[model samples]
Every structure is written in C-alpha cells, then in structure tokens.
Target: MTHDLLVIGGGINGCAIAREAALLGLSVLLVERDDLASHTSSASTKLIHGGLRYLEQYEFRLVREALGERERMLAIAPHLVHPLTFVLPHDHAVRPWWLVRAGLWLYDALGFDSSLPRSRSLRRDDTGYQTPLRQAYRGFVYSDAWVDDARLTVLNAVDAADHGAEILTRTGFELAEQAGDHWRVTLSDGRTLEARAIVVAAGGWTTQAMTAMGVPPRGKLRLVRGSHIVVPELFEGDHAYILQQPDRRIVFAIPYPGGTMLGTTDVAVEDPSDARISPEETQYLCDAANRYFRRQVSPAEVVSDWSGIRALYDDGAGSAAEVTRDYVLELHDKGAPVLGVFGGKITTARALAEDALGRLAPVLGFDAHPVSRARVLPGAMIADIETLARQVAERWPFLDPHDIDRMARAYGSRLIELLDGVDSVRDLGRALPGGMTEREARFLHETEFARAADDVLDRRTKLGLGMSEEERRAFADWWATAFPAG
Candidate 1:
C-alpha cells in the first residue's frame, strides 16, 4: 500500500505536517529515528510569541503570522499553552527608550487581532517586577505565552494518529527512489514501503535525508546550536524577563518547575546530531543572568542544560544570531514530488504545516484545502484546565492538588480516561518520585510511545527535574522489571 505522503522527522514541523495531511484525508506515514521530540523540538526556550525582537530585523510579516498562530494555539491547545507577561527592561544607553517603546507599539500593532493585552510601561519600582533586578531599570510589560514544548510535538502526533496517520518513532528514513507516479522508500530497519510523495521535515537532518533520497540540497543549511541552562528560580512572580545583552542579542529567564530556564546562545556548529551545551555557553548564560538579577548564579549552580541545533535556511547572514527564523518550503516537483522544510519555530509550526499542505495537496493530485484552524488538539477536548483539575481532585481525593494539576496539564481530558477504572490510591500502584504513579508510567508507555524512562521523566513531563538521583534509579529499576527491553 502506498501512503499518500511520507513525512520524515518527528519534530514539531514534521508532526505538524503529518497531522495536517491526515486531517485532509490523505494517508500519511511519519518516520523518526528516535523518540518523538528527542531532538530540537523538546529543547526549546518554550515561548509562544510573535518574536518581538524580530522587529529589529524587519520581519513584520513573519511576526504577524506567528502572533496569529499564537492566538489560535491558545484556543486550540489551552491545556499545554498558557499566557505569561514578559518584562523587557531597557537600558537607555544601549537602545533609547523611545526606540524600545516604538518596537513595542509595532509588536502590538502586528498582533492587533490577538486577544492578548497590548504592551505597556512597567515602572522600575514595580515591586513584582523589580524585586530580583539589580538596578530596577524601567521596563515594558507585554503579553506572550509559555508552553510544554515536548508535549506540543507529541500532541500533534497524537492528533495525527487519531486522524489515521502512521507515526513510526525509532524508524529512520533510509532512501527513496522515484518509481513512476509513486516513490519506493526504505526504512532503517530494512523494510521497504511506497509513498505518493515525500516531505523532508527532518529539521537538522533534512539535507542528509534529501541526499539519500536523491534530492539536491536546494538551499544552504546553517546549523546554529541554541543552548539553555536551568538554575534556581530567579524571581518570585510567574512573569518572565527578556534581557537584552550588550551584543544586541536577547536571553529569556522563565520560571520552570523547581528552577528557572535561562537561555539561549547562538553558536555555529558543523554537526547537528551531536549538539551538547558547552561550558562557555553555560558561563555566558550565567553571566547574562548575573548582569540583571541581584541573585547571581555560577556554572556550578546549574542543575540541568540542553542544546538543540537550528537547521536555519542560510540567507547569507554573517553571524548565527543574525540568521532569520522564518521557514522556507522548497518543493522539488519534477515527477514524484518532495517538499523540504527549513527553519521554523513552535509558534509557527501549525501555520507552516497549513501552508505546506495547502501547497502540497494540489501538487500531489489532491484538491488544496485549508486546514481548520479552530480545531482543538486531541488533549484540548476539555479546554478548561481548572475544571478538569477539580474533577480529578474530586475523583482521587487522596492525590495532592499539585499532582492532579500536573496530570491535568499533561494529559488534559485524557487524564480521566487514563484513570478510567481507578477509585483509590491503591489502584494507582507504586508511587515514583516527583509524583509519577505506576499508572501514569503505564499510560505513557502504552499510549504515548514512551520506550524508556527518560521519555517519561524528561519529555512527557518535567518530573525528572524534581526527582532525586535515587528516585530516578528506582523508577528505572522498576521500569526494567515491568517492561523489559525486547
């Protein structure tokens, strides 16, 4: 059987493409070499914003489209995405206050159709905003969003599966040969399949896959490594801070579960698969944070760190930081067609997918149709998170409110289905560290394509951050006994 579309990669862009194609009634098969979101998709700074800084680059159209999608996602995936106010403290010496204000105005104007509040002045003395700052510089507060990046990717795959898309994680795309109307494709596992067309959405692996599939690079790929460091919580409030560096780059400090997530340095690298945070990057983040907050952190205080390669479409930018974040879709429609996805952000993946399918459908012999932007993701069937949390609490009064809230956010309406037969604590089975129950582990493994404990601890949830080494070991031991490796 020939699938209508073969989607390579399981990151945000790849999964979004599969979900969109399947929703259009096209048979789709998506192959990922690792677990879903094991790469760049999960290693994000975790924002759903219009890229206010892009105003400096004059990417108005890109920001406008991203902002529009940001609003749509707030409605469609309310469980995984939540609003957060970002405070951008300005130093008049570097950028004049008027310039900063003008950028904010433009940012708001671009997102005029969005439901989020407009940007406004934040006084330096504002207690909630200044308590952690060293000098209490005047600031501007604007609305944006924070999201569970990993879950966002996985949820897209879940919806794609619900729509009959075959999602094959741990399956790699080896090569493909054009065979008349369809292409015969081979997987890493030595299985051969057929597809009507191909979409190389492999993120950093795009160029490599295209070459194996006998397609040209079509464009240059600049592999910029973006790294993040998790440290002790920097401030008290739920609000995040966008700090401007002397080099004109911006770093964000957002609240994580037990710590704060500070990132991201732009450094060029040759290899995409071996992206790991460097000591210099860690020091850079620490120094960047130290320059703003009264509380200073060293590389020693860093609790966790991760790195992801941005496979950006090189437009001849001199530096990595100067590279554009906009995505470019290259369609090689010679005979049997193949589409290539370049750089894109989580905030723009849905829109990118919509655009890709609106273009690919027609080329693949199907009528081009617009995807339903209002369609909620699978977990968002019950949108009201608080209501769902209350229901879970009422059902499992023995569970802590915090744990219930976590489960509700992670699984949303599916939490109820996850515990369909549960009535008491005894039914929850063994309790792991960070409040992961035996039942939740089973749910992730049986339903969410969790092959290892890290997929549960690090990806499906942020539980690993709060878990002790001993606790992680215990969970791993139990997992090995329960689901022994095949």
Candidate 2:
C-alpha cells in the first residue's frame, strides 16, 4: 500500500502527526513495533501541564508554548484532560517563599487564556491539616492539568482511523530504502508499505529508526530515565502534591485511580531503549515522599513501579533533570524527505503535530489546513464532564463511584457507547479474571485495538497495578482466548 506519509512509532507524536495528517485529507499509515504507547508515552507522570520547574532552566519559550497547548487540549478534551491543583509543600531545604513566589509569577505570566485557576498561597495551619504533612511546612497551591497519557495516544489513533488512516500496532519496520520516487519499507511481519514521505516519532528508539533508514543524525538525542511508584490512597481530595526532598530534586504524590502515586527520579541514560528503574531509584522515590508526609510509605507499600525514557535534545547539561524538554524537527532528503522528531512533552504533542503538518505541506502536496485547536476529540463529543458522569452513574448506581468517575474521565462521551445496553454492574458483562469487567476488556479489545492483555490491564485501565498476580494470569488467559490474532 502506498500512503502520502508513513509515520513510524505510534507513540504520542506519531499518533498526533498521523491524526493531523489524515484530518487534512492526506492518506497516512501509522506503524508501531509494539502496542501503541507501550513505552515512555504511557509511563509519563501523566500530567498535561507546562513544566513549572523549566522556569529555573530559563526555558521560557518552551514553557509558554506548552502552557498554551495545555489550555487548547483542555478545551477540546475536557473529560480526559482536566484542571488539577498542585500543592508545592515548602521547606527549609528548598527555596524560600520569595523564590517560590517569583517562580509562580513567571509560571502564571507565561501561561495565557488559562482555563484553570491561578496559583495562591496557603496557610500551613489551615488546609495543611488535610494533607499528610509535617507541622513546620507551609505551601502554595497552583494550577496545572492531568491526563490519561495512554488513552490520549489511543484516542489520537482512533481519530486517525476515523479519517481513513491505517494504524497498525505491533507491526515492526524491518528496513527502508528509496524505490524510484518513493521509499519502500518492509515490516517485520512481512507487510510492505510505500510512502512519499516518512515521519520518525519513535520516542526512545528514534535514533535507532534513523540508523535503520540509513539516515545520519542531524542532531543528537539525550536519553533520561524517570521512574514512578504507586502506593495506597494517601489523601481524600483531588489536589496533587509536589514535595521537595533533602536531595533537592522534587517528586510528586498525585492521586491516581484509587491510589496515590509517588514519583519520579531522573537519571541520565546511555541508551534510550534499554533504560529501566534501578533499585536505588525506587528507594529514592520512597525517601522523597517520606520527607514531607507525616505518614511514611515504605518500599513495601509500592504496589507497582514503572519508568520512562525522555527523548530530550542533547543540550549540554550535567544532570538529567536539568536537560531541556523542548523538541525539534529534522528533515532529510534521501528520496522523499523524512521528518524526524526529537524531544517533546505530552502536553505539547498536539501543537507539535500542527507544526509538523505545516512542514509537510510541500512534501505531501496539500495546502496546510486551518488549525483544529478547538475541535473535540472523537470520544470527547460533549460540553461538560458532569453530564457524562451523571449519565454513567444512572446506569450503574451500585458500581464503585470512583471507578465510574475514572471511566468517565478515560472514555468521555463514549463511556455511554462503551457501556451500551448494560443494566447493572453485572450486566456490564462477566467479571474480568481480575478487578476489571469483561465489558471494559471488550471495549478495549474491540474498540480501542488492545491486542495484548497487558495493554488492557496496564495501560488501558491500570488494573494490572491493582489486581493480584493470580488474577492477572487468569485475565491474560481469558484475553488470549477472546482476542486471538487471525
């Protein structure tokens, strides 16, 4: 099959690029070596905000651009992406109030048309009682957005398919070479595809893809591994906490699903694809969380832990945490030009996709379409989240309220379509061999193209973190029978 563009890597950048390209009337094919978002994209801190700490690195432009994109995504996908308040617990080890205040000022100023609430000071004695904090600490609360990173990636692919783009996950690219006016690419599974232009959005393995295409690197990518750990529920409210440890590196304790999430440690990596969390990294996260919280969560409390590699630009930085998280596009003219993407944040992927489309105008021979910044995502075809929540609640009053809210957040207006004709929680279908239900599993498999049990359990619904090992095995067995490949 010949496509106008063949996007390698169905991670966030590739999915976004393919969706934008397809929406602009170009034929696109997105190929992923494994399941979509099986790597860094899914393992993100899962926030959709401009990096507040980037202000310290003097990354004003990157922070500003990401902030703008944050609001745009929130407006378009209010269900999946929503405003989240963060408490930056202050201490003597960290910067003083004046310095933190200045940072907040810059953060608020850099962001425009903000849909979220602005930052404010909080009295330690007031709401501090609600948090798991020491008596000596006071803090400021600020606004940012949180996202279901994996779902965001999947929704983009689904949207691309809606616009006639062919998205194939677990389809590895074997080789690429110029065949006359086009590039002929071979997939590991024996599928051959032809395309006029190519996009390498392969996140961690971006450099590998360039090498495979026989294209020399125009720029370098710095791989940085970041790790996060999940613990039992810590707080009751919807707010997130960013606590500074004695080591000076800050970690977050955010509300995730029913539990609380503590993360992440940044360590420079020699290889992007091979980076994984070490024993020390896990210890570091637990110790960081223990610094501020009155109730200490030990290493044993960690239900699940994961890591992601940041495909950062090779900026001259001594520390991985200090590396700039900005991105750039490199175009090569072997046959049709191949656009290589390097270093982008989850919050800014949509804007990056738009910019990528602008760059491909001449290559694809299509006029750059007007921006679709305000357009809602496919499942986000609704005005508000409350209505969607109420609609889902009406169907299953017995279902755990928290789970219902999570599904509404993950699936949006499509939650109704996903649970169609179900009367009670039991009618949602047979219970999964695990904590999830068969209806949710089928929704992921039949609708979202989840081919593997881990894709549904880990990324699609996060049941892998919550379920027991025996439960996981049973679920895997059931999934294998339900979704066997032809």
Local distance difference test, each candidate: 0.90, 0.84
RMSD of each: 1.3, 2.1
User: How much lDDT does candidate 2 score?
Assistant: 0.84
lDDT (10s digit) by residue, model 2, range 1-486: 688999999889999999999989889999998899999999999999889888889999999999998988888888788788898878855677888889998899888578688888866565643456755556788999888899899999998998999988889888998887689999888988789988999987888898888886688888889898888777768889988777667898999864788888888878777657788888888788777777777788777788999898787888888888899998886566789999998998988899998988976678987556877787788778778788768766777777777788778888888877877767777777656778888888877879999998888777677677898889889888877781
lDDT (10s digit) by residue, model 1, range 1-486: 889999999999999999999989999999998989999999999999899888888989999999999999999999999999998888776788999999999999999898888999988668889889998688799999999999999989999998999988878888799998789998999999999899999988899888888888779899999999999988998999999998888999999876889999999999988689999999999999998999999999998999999999998989999899999999988889999999989999999999999778777878757775989987787849999998888877888898888889988888988988998889989887777889989988888778888888999997888889998898888888888961
Candidate 2: which pairs clash? none
Q: Candidate 2: deviation at residue 420, Å?
A: 3.3
Q: List the lowest-lDDT window of 10 residues for candidate 2.
A: 128-137
- Give stretches of model 1 more than 4 Å off: none
Q: Which residue pairs in candidate 1 have backbone atoms (N, alpha carbon, C) closer than 3 angstroms, thus clashing?
A: none
* lDDT measured at residue 5 in model 1 versus the true structure, 0 to 100: 97
The TM-score, computed over Cα atoms with residue i paired to residue i, of candidate 2 is 0.95
